[model samples]
Target chain A: MSERGKPNELGEYRPLSYFQLMEVSLRELLVEKGIVSDAEVQATLEDMRARGPDAGARVVARAWVDADFKARLLENGTRACEAFGLDVPALRLVVVENTPQVHNVIVCTLCSCYPRMLLGLPPDWYKSRHYRSRVVREPRTVLQEFGLRLPEAVQLRVHDSTADMRYLVLPMRPAGTAGWSEAQLASIVTRDCMIGVAVPDTSGSE
Target chain B: MPQVAARPQYPTDHPSVPVRFAAGDRVRVRKTFPLGHIRTPFYIRGHSGVIERYCGNFPVPEELAQMRSGLPAQPLYRVRFLQREVWPDYAGRADDVIEIEIFQHWLEAVKT
Candidate 1:
């Protein structure tokens, strides 16, 4: 059995929350009705847990090195990722490139609709109401909170993922990194970089 | 016993509504709100913006939630609104903007 929600020092397990109880009931019903096997559900959960931002990082790294790939990625993100052999099934990805004049960021004002297929799951703060509400209202301030201070001249473009589309920020490649291998470049393309909250730091890569 | 059919799969290329606006066209989001699963954000309602790009068509989310065929699909566009226009006290740069994906039904063309 999973050790989730383990009891405290008293050795007594706490009751499941309302949503947790509902989830359990639903899962049980689905299994009982043969809609989905327990093994399939468990495997899916494992698959979700196994996903990480490496796929996204590699894509960014490839974009940095290959102009053709970058053009394809910018024009059709979903097709480019698929052609790259990444499993982006049914994902209508919209990639926003960041440049010297313009900076791009993403926020789902309605809810945390992130590019999970590429970047894995979203961070807790990304889902928090604080980030969701404030990011769209005052993005600079929110970005500042994340230690990303943009120059006054850089125009900020905040994307609200409100509908059938998903967004990924293509952060500008930092300077002083010449002749770097694709793997080395990908190492710096962290999850936060793709999410637009943070940029790749060259200082840590070397 | 009656025969049951498999769940219908709505193809992404299914017949959709005509695209009204194009890139660079000025448009305004409709302010009206009806009770249902609406994808349009409340903050963008009644605001004017420029069509950044046409993102193609997809099933209407409102109808999808009601267990109905959301067809024909609706044309969606990425509308770019100036931050200052959206929030009067927006502290970001004057050129700072926010873009949202809105369906055709929620947008009306803005006269120059």
Candidate 2:
């Protein structure tokens, strides 16, 4: 046994990822390194790949059209979810509304506590530690970097979702969606809108 | 009540069968004491918010790392909210909405 994960001065062993393991090529290396197995890795990837954006999309789509639904979301988020045909039995839910006055963004400091149910798998940026640590303190600058300019009048809020209560962004309806049907409204509901970075606009979405 | 472990290790990957919450679906975040490996941040717990976006289901990172509960990862959402509503008398900017990623395990139906 040479060693495992991090040699002191003589250079014995060290921790590694898949790419790293490929370079070393040692079965014992895997056992000692505790690398995630191919079976597990394959399963995780398959599981992730199997996930769809429809469930979360439907929630966002509904919020875009129904006023009463919006109100209910504000009042009782979990209950309101039921009106839209969601089945949330034991888990707790919280609603976060987006208005012109406030622009909200979310990040997970520990790992990534994403609203996957409503939005789907989080974008690459959301998982980056850069977005997680920085967004909480400097959200305005981050949003600006993402091409969303905010006014001095509008405040920027950063929420870190932990273990207890999960959050969602109820974006303000776009200017021209008054006559649009629910399907139409949902179509324009971009992931960014749900994230509160940009409002839903048909040009880019279409 | 069986005494819960102070902190337990999570699993790498488990099959997630989630029950989703749709828009206008009123919900509340149950206040749970910190336990095991989890991804939900520390700042937004307890405070109530609204559902903004329904992100598609995916593997929960903390769960995948085998650092938290073994519950299979499921679909999640990106909810939005007002800064004023979450925090009061805060004079940062006037207009700001808070968006977050909430999992299915932490949601409860809001009673009308």
Candidate 3:
């Protein structure tokens, strides 16, 4: 279980951080102690991998098509998501609406607390120190870095996902998307759009 | 295998402590730096804001993070603060705001 100071074929040794070493020790102890089986860990990994932006896209697309569903989602996010067969577990999900005048962005300053059941693993940049620190102070500038330039009139609202609750931004439906099918609309909703960094390009669907 | 008891569920409607603030209430975040894991960010500490919504009552994360019984659930509120207020040199528009979910323990009602 101890890989620290282990020499490689190239006669080079790489040291693991205290946190990494503790993680390895704890994991091995758990497996050896029969608390968590290797197969169970693999299954959990597979489950996490199976979820992605596609699920979030489906929810957003459904909300766009059904006003009642959108209301439920805004009112009770976790329950509404369960209607779509998404398991929310003990964590509560809050869906913030992006209106014509207000845009929403999500960040976790303390740690990468995200809606993994819906959005999958957050992008590397989302977990970076720069994104966590800068997004709250200068959201507009951060959004601009993502190539999303909002009009001056649109107010920027950054949601700091700090607690046990998870947040998902329900971006405003793009113009000219009228009469668009749910599947068609879902295809245009990228991960960045749901994260509030980018907007769905409606012209592509047309 | 030890028989595990059903875990306690802390619902939003039922809070262990008395909720002093509600949505639209003016509140100021406490500036205390308690040891162990905390959800309150440093930037928001000692800052004033308005409660945007009542998120729900849940286990106090500070205790939960230490693997202790997060008993006596605390109310969590979504507080909205202007970016300019949070940062002195905030380059964003004055109208821009950031919302953070904070526990009841870290907030005090502002004397409006």
Compare the candidates by lDDT and give the number of the best one: 1
Provide backbone clash counts, one per model.
0, 90, 0
Q: Model 1: clashing residue pairs?
A: none
> What share of the reference contacts survives in each candidate?
0.87, 0.51, 0.75
Off by over 4 Å in 1: A1-12, B1-11
Question: What does candidate 3's lDDT look like per residue over A1-206, in tens digits?
Answer: 33455876788888887987887788889999999987887788788777788988999999999999999998878889898787768658889999988999999999899888788889999999999998898788889999999899998999999887788899888888888899999999989998899988977657
Over A1-206, each residue of candidate 1 has an lDDT whose tens digit, in order, gives 24445785778888777977788889889999999999999998888778899999999999999999999898889989999999887688889999999889998988899888998888899999999999999999999999999999999999999997899899888898789999999999999899888999999868
TM-score of each: 0.93, 0.54, 0.90
lDDT for position A164 in model 3: 70
- Please report, as a value between 0 and 1, the fraction of native contacts recovered by candidate 1: 0.87
Isolated chain B TM-score per model: 0.88, 0.67, 0.86
Question: By TM-score, is 1 or 2 better?
Answer: 1
Q: Residue A1 in candidate 1 has what lDDT?
A: 20
Q: What tens digits encode model 2's per-residue C-alpha lDDT throughout A56-122?
A: 5567777767678877776666677777787654334566677777666666677676666566678
Which runs in model 2 stand beyond 4 Å of their true positions?
A: A1-47, A87-91, B1-112
Model 1 chain A worst lDDT run, 10 consecutive residues = A1-10
The Cα error of candidate 3 at residue B78, in Å, is 0.5
Candidate 3 residue pairs in clash (backbone atoms < 3 Å): none
- Scoring model 1 with DockQ, what do you get? 0.46
